[model samples]
Target: MTFSHDPVEEVARALAASGLLLRGGFSLGEDEAAPAGLSGAPARSILLIGQAGPAPWPHFQRWRERQARDIANPLDSWSREVIGAVAKEFGARAVSPSDRPYLPFQQWAMRAEGLKPSPLGILMHPTYGLWHAYRGALLFENGLGLAEPHAAIHLCDTCVAKPCLKSCPVDAYSGQGFAHEICLGHVRGPHGATCRTAGCLDRNACPYGTNYRYPADVQAFHMAAFAGL
Candidate 1:
């Protein structure tokens, strides 16, 4: 069932009004497993929906202010609502990173955007840097005539200073791995005031996308969520 117009373009237009972008997409090979649809059938292609920077913050805040108090996982909830609407309108299945059993979103992201992970495991985009995020995705039963993701030059490869790894107050990130417990413990302690009020020092240290950095309030919200405060 093909449409006269490009469905991908139509979807992109619809998403733009909400400050979401069609990051990119890929078709699934017959041998590869696909995410199940609402009817429990496999989707043939997936288009990632996300924000490049702080574009969606204002919209999300507006919706958040109108919601009931004590809403758990407010951001995730909001993504589901917005992305779900888009999916419904386009006859697609909506999925989130926080979904149960976790749908390999990181792997999907790397595939879709040709983005390589930074030392912190965040996909670093050339333009958006460490500030972008994958809010949700639209899965279609049939191909949407999406273009293949193109590879970009890795920014970290050329970065000599690598200030991000050194900026952490607790040295949580290292070659071995991220010391999650230590990082969490520090964020919950008294000295965490800086990180709590601003954001992760390491993330802020990234040289790219300074203009696209998340606002202080947004960072605070995420910090509070991270520390379970």
Candidate 2:
């Protein structure tokens, strides 16, 4: 189907209504390598889409609750369906971060939004801070004039407090890298109840995006998932 409006704005608006954001996008050169599953597709451009903050949490929570009645992996399934529908509307292919062969979502986000990693390794958004996430992306056969890459100031470079490093009781994060096993063990232990209920202390300790922090239920959901509950 032919689009009468600017496809990028149209898609962005539609996604926004669903509590998702069209984070940014970029054009892929003809010779640039495509990710594993997309090698055969005539993909020319990509639109990075995702939830930015707590604005999407209520919508997502309702969706999850409804989907949980009958669906396993509600979060992934919901995200795929939402992104898939948008792709179909725009005559593009939908790809998710959770997809096999794992698309370079972090690299894509960095390139698309000019983001840098926080101490915890999560990409620190200029405005959203550590509260944003890339749920999925849309690929089209034809190129759309995507937004220019942002030259946002890297917030971490100036923050002297760096509370994310000091707040984790288990010291799960450090300059050396994340202690995954230690984090997992703590999350699974009784002492992790607070973390399980309120989300990672280190993540919550971030001072940049307190306004965008996920609500309690949403944070609890993520923590439970992290703890494998």
Q: Which regions of candidate 2 fall more than 4 Å away from where they truly are?
A: 36-39, 68-70
RMSD (Cα, Å) for all candidates, in order, is 1.2, 1.9
Q: Write the per-residue lDDT of candidate 1 for residues 164-229, one digit (tens) a residue.
A: 999998998999888989999999998989999999999999998888999999899999999899
Error of 2 at 102 (Å): 0.9
lDDT per residue for candidate 2 within 1-229, as digits (tens), equals: 3678988889999898779999888888879986432445667787899887767766767777765465666777878988888878777788999888888999888888889899999899878889988889988777787766976789999999999999999999987899999999999897888898889999999999777888877888787767678
**TM-scores for every predicted model:** 0.96, 0.93
Backbone atom clashes (below 3 Å) for every candidate: 0, 0
Distance from true location, Cα of 167 in model 1, Å: 0.9
Which pairs of residues clash in candidate 2, taking residues 3 or more apart in a chain or in different chains? none
The 10 consecutive residues of candidate 2 with the worst lDDT sum are 34-43
C-alpha RMSD (angstroms) for model 1: 1.2
